[model samples]
Target: MTSLPESPRPAPTRAAGAFEVRLSDSPLPEPDRRALIASPRFGTVFTDHMARCTWTAGGGWSDRRIEKYGPLNLNPAAAVLHYGQEIFEGLKAYRHADGSVWTFRPEANAARFARSAHRLALPQLSAEDFLGSIEALVRVDAAWVPSGEETSLYLRPFMYASEDFLGVRATQQAEYLVIASPVGPYFAGGVKPVSIWVAQDYHRSGAGGTGAAKCGGNYAASLLPQQEAQSKGCDQVCFLDASTNSLLEELGGMNVFIVGADGSVATPELSGTILEGVTRSSILRLLADSGHDVQERPIALAELRAGLADGSVTEVFACGTAAVITPIGRLAGADFDLAVADGAAGRVTTGLREALTDIQYGRAADPHGWMHRLL
Candidate 1:
């Protein structure tokens, strides 16, 4: 199987050009919109508009538009339907007390989106273009940005092969889109320590596979394992490295972290087999800033299990866009269950979560300028 070289990309511009904006003729009634935002669910409900851009072999990326949110008209034999050439990203739009909307590390998301596109043989949406598309969509649906507590507008940017074909090859046509949902919290009970299930029977992705890419195929492969994890009463599944199945790679959708009694923190290093999480990177910086030794190295499952038995590792947690920081209260498998810090959210976990959320919600000073103002 041959791979397509990345097409020469155009210089990215801010989302300030004369972009087309077509408002919905029949948007959701204000009464319903207000009620919906009061207690919004995750990912199911969408805002009034979406941003779209198309890419073609000869034309590059063009035809950008912000139109009403609705179902797409995909061909019966679309390449994405068969070949699974697709990638996506997840981030949030936070509403501050001063009525400004901001997002954390959008440029990081854009850069990672481009990396995922490259790995999947799809056209790279410029960082400017990605940020601009997000800005455009959020601008039209500004009212949909939820407030109070940890509520925010969840943004999902995705791209997939749109060409109609039966045989497997590089994508000739693709579509990039941005849609948003008002969400309250990822874990229904909010940020707390949760249990983790160790997947001993399956591996997420192998060496030189799409494990590191934020693509649907990698997630699709983990569904069965995730089902198993849930059946075992675990909130999420922990996957080991595919090559050895001993070193900790990451949680199904989030990154894993461990803290030691020596006031040190560490997470699984990027081994080309795990998705590089934006939140995970931020936590490392914050940990170092808070006078904790931060380590980014391969973590062995045996060491983690032993650390729990001993007192080397005092806390364990998971980090991602949806669930900012969830402490792993328990690590359970078929044969054994290890209690983590008396099955409670630890000090390190809570402090890190607070620091990150503070920067996100404009409660604290953003020294890194990570928040990009969408409105």
Candidate 2:
């Protein structure tokens, strides 16, 4: 018997103003909205609307709109529920002193989003659409952008398989959505040093795995390890390379760095097992520009421990979109626990955080043109 030809897959394309805005009739009152923005509990409160779009295997992307933020009606057998075909990106919009709103390295996030989509077997979203969705949502909910120090509207853009079949393959239907939340500092009070528990047993990702992808499953795998960290009186968890189990990979949700006593710096090289963090890359650039010797190579656990013991490793820190830069003050494992350089925020860590945030909040000159104005 003759088989029918396969359907032609649509190529990814860019379009301006792809997300049609639909204003919410029941928006939160100004007083209530301001109250929530004054003290947002980091990802708990949402804005008035969300940006959404749909994609099909044969028809490509369609039905783009910004609508009321509400529940989603998904079939019980949705592919994302079973196969875990999902990817997400996190970024923020900063309100400058002059009332202008901007985002840092959004194009980088867009590129990474596309990369993640490919890894998750999802349709690639054009950078233009990725950014347009964010801009549209933020424009409609510009009131949600907070102006306080270390406060901004956090943008979460995610894509998931929406198909209602369980054939154990990539879904034919998918959905992409962008939601905004006004958030305070990722760490509650202020930027302070955080203790970390080294995961001696669990690995975040392995070689030939979805380690490099910014997907939910990777974060899901780290929850237990994170819980263990909290139980051990640490704030976060660190994962080592699965193959060697000695090479420092990264923290649960952030990239890590080791600052040497000689003013040199090093971070684990992109080994396809660590998410390529936008904040991590920006910090590297800032460090390089400031004349510090920056190296990206495998940072072994033994090396870090020895350096810490001998006072060669002056500081350790982690970086991500939410926290920007967090100093790792202590590292504990099954057999050993140690403080990192007086268990305080190091000079390099503080300086890097200030420099990055300065640029982000428009306090310093953006020499690299990394800031993208959204409003």
Question: Model 1's lDDT to the true fold?
Answer: 0.88
Q: Please count the clashing residue pairs in each candidate, in the order shown.
A: 0, 0
User: Which runs of model 1 end up more than 4 angstroms from their true locations?
Assistant: 1-14
lDDT of 1 by residue, 189-249 (tens): 8777888999988888889999889999888888898999999998889998877878998
lDDT of 2 by residue, 1-375 (tens): 122342332222234367787888999999999899988889999999999999999999999999999999999999999999999999999888777778999999999999999999999999889988988888789899998878999999999999999999998999999999999989986788899999989999998999999999999999999999999999999999999899999998999999999999999999999999999999999999999999999999989999989999989999999999998889899988888994476889999999999999888999999998777
Judge candidate 2 against the unseen true structure and give its global Cα lDDT, from 0 to 1.
0.91
Clashing pairs in 2: none
Work out the TM-score per prediction. Answer: 0.95, 0.95
Q: Which residue pairs collide in model 1, if any?
A: none
